[model samples]
Target: PEEQFEPDPSKKNLVILGTGWGAVSLIKKLDTENYNVIVISPRNYFLFTPLLPSCTTGTVEHRSIMEPIRSITRHKQAAVKYYEAEATKIDPERKVIMMDDNSDVKGTANKTEVPYDMLVVSVGAENATFGIPGVKEHSCFLKEIGDAQQIRKKIMDCVETATFKGQSPEEVERLLHMVVVGGGPTGVEFAGELQDFFDQDIKKWIPEISDKFKVTLIEALPNVLPMFSKQLIDYTESTFKEEKITIMTKTAVKKVTDKTVEAEATGPDGKKTVEVMPYGLLVWATGNAVRPVVKDLMSQIPAQKDSRRGLAVNEYLVVQGTKDIWATGDCAVAGYAPTAQVASQEGAFLARLFNTMAKSEAIESQIHELSSTLNLKPGNPGEIATAIEAHEKQLRRIKDIKPFHYTHQGSMAYIGSERAVADVSWLNGNFATGGGLTYLFWRSAYLSMCFSTRNRVLVVVDWLKSKAFGRDVSRE
Candidate 1:
């Protein structure tokens, strides 16, 4: 017989899955006095994802931007339970979740059953490949800290190998050519950082490579940074041209193979041409794909038919066709853009609403007991209905929790060491893009948002070291 794990009956168990922006924000705001909270995620720390591009070039250390879950949990009223595990199945009927401790996806290893009174699923999205060949096998990703480290190692490897004792020009060119797919903020930012490194450090130390070292950014769309305003987008394109970074717009990668990538592009003659370009390092930033576990959960629900993104949720962030189970962030289609800002806001909102519902329930119970003990006015229909209606109104309010909406706090992207793009709002319907002064503001803003004082200091140190001595070129 399997181990029978029982729910903690001492307190209401609230289990939240995922450690992304949404889960972290929710855990931070929830009043732990109302329940026993449990956070389950594969990652033990919450990552500040916006500044990840700098990490690849060692401009910012990975640890400086990561905050441990324990630190945030300690802020709660009660001792919150944390399980570094993946939730495989959510059995709403049994009020239990099937989770496993094995690294990656579990196969033969036994799974554990943990019951919960309330569940929040914020397990985020995965890298979306869109069935494009050669992507999973050859390209590197930029979604995690490990990915950054790998890219850094690859950069060093590219520079070292190309400049090796007696390598041919063709081989060196191939080795130095870094190809980045998808022209979103991530790809653009990464390419910008890579170019900066080559211009500032590699050129100074390893001059033999010359201008053969190139970075190419490919976007299927007509322009890069589609989410930004026209002014900012134009600014980025102009900056890329000035920086000599290749922008291959209107080009879609059909297949990525080791040594070369096969792509189709429309030419100036309105005809299509197939091109193959040899590359050294490839970064795939084609947004996110659905993780297997999330897909399995969505498949179980029929109402999730129209919900191709992820689990469909009601206004309360509750997964449709279930009760006492809620989800947020990228994992579920919360009817908002899958961004760090949106996810965090949804999590915090859920926390506040959860606190109110709990208090309302307690008050309702007290009123019921008082009415029964007093035994007064059994014929008062208005009082009875009104009493029931008031709390019922509370329940409706909880149910009527509005669907998540994304708040655009403006857009900012790091183009190089001292340049950035900001599509921000100003007074009286004014918006502008000024690189010089805006660059400083961007640096200061990100520095202020670091996880802690220690993180702030560490990031500052990385920046100063990079500015003074230049980046460390050692691969290891």
Candidate 2:
């Protein structure tokens, strides 16, 4: 058993947590031959999160965007080990991580520990509910594959239930209403997709449920997409308006009940009034928060005492107050937004940094061996000087690795009815676009960003299928 899991004595154990953007990017770029790589995460696949909203309405099948972790590891130069488990704790002092298999069918040993010479914490953040009551129990989230599947099933269920025999008009209206919380890209895109589904498929499948169907987006802020440009935000709102999706700005959700959402709306006169909104499906996508494992690690490190959202990391992504430990993605606050673009950049930086460090160590070891040989032989100084100079040159090159830098690409979001908005950077100026053309750009960009060719092909197929025959509306 020891030999089965024992790491190579000659190489360092590089344990990476999570299979999100950061971890997958690192694995793809890392030189596995230089170290023993081990990856651990609850999910064994990488989900393309940008297009996750489409999955909710069956515009894209959930599996279309999932790339198996094994598919990546198999291409590596070395045999990388993967564990389908969740990291429970990180003992920085002992350089060990405690993990537990969270699947329903338990293994013989559900929990275990693994030591690492270098640890990368890429476990991404979770949905932020802001302590709102009934959110966790009543509302659906848009973060995982399961969440999307559940939403799809629930959508059909509501439609079927609304049309059940002897159903009152009032009850039918309540069952047909879909509510979405937050105005970020996720919430906005989901609401857009939901409307698209209703317009393109649901209306045709159940024409009687027509006019009664309503999609409402509730945002606590005065405007949606606070991160997007003013032009794009306005365009999104206009698109939603045209699509008949109600946008309730300056509305804060106080609580969620089984069938109603309690919210406080601020009027133009700055007056606040509470209202109860009834709906069959409620999707919550406000923001993200630090995971429990990250919070636990922060508590153990004195330097991370001030980090509230996630782990505090230095410029090179090294966890502050801890050695040989690094963090990336949403789990590391690197003075950037919790977006995939930032996380992927950080992961690529760490790959180069680790490769440089490995080269430096090998050069140092060679230099040490050469000097030792020279000392014992008392041989020609020329030979010794030449060997030392070569090692020094290699060491100099290795030390030239630069620190991590984040470059903002752009922000894009779908706003229903073949419309989209984009705020991009180009030629030292901002390019803000909206409408049909931007929607095409958005589609092409996301299709190209798919993790693998397989996923890209599947996603395209899903798109064509939905366009040609309409999205599948089966409850299951």
Q: Who wins the lDDT comparison?
A: 2
**Which run of 10 residues does model 1 get worst, by summed lDDT?**
1-10
**What would the per-residue lDDT of candidate 2 be over residues 1-476, giving only the tens digit for each residue?**
11234468999999999999999999999998799889999999998999899999999999999999988888877788999999999998898999999999897999999999999999999999999999999999999999999999999999999999999998998999999999999999999999999999999999999999999999999999999988888888988998999999999999999999999999999999999999999999999988999999999999999889898898999999988999999999889999999999999899889888888998999999989888888868789979899889989988987778898988888988988899988777889999999999999999999998899999999999999999998888
Q: What is the lDDT of residue 218 in candidate 2?
A: 99
lDDT of 2: 0.93
lDDT for 341 in candidate 2 is 91
- TM-score of each model, in listed order: 0.90, 0.98
Candidate 2: regions farther than 4 A off: 1-6
C-alpha lDDT score of every prediction, in listed order: 0.84, 0.93
Model 2 residue 179 distance off true place after TM-score fit, in angstroms: 0.5
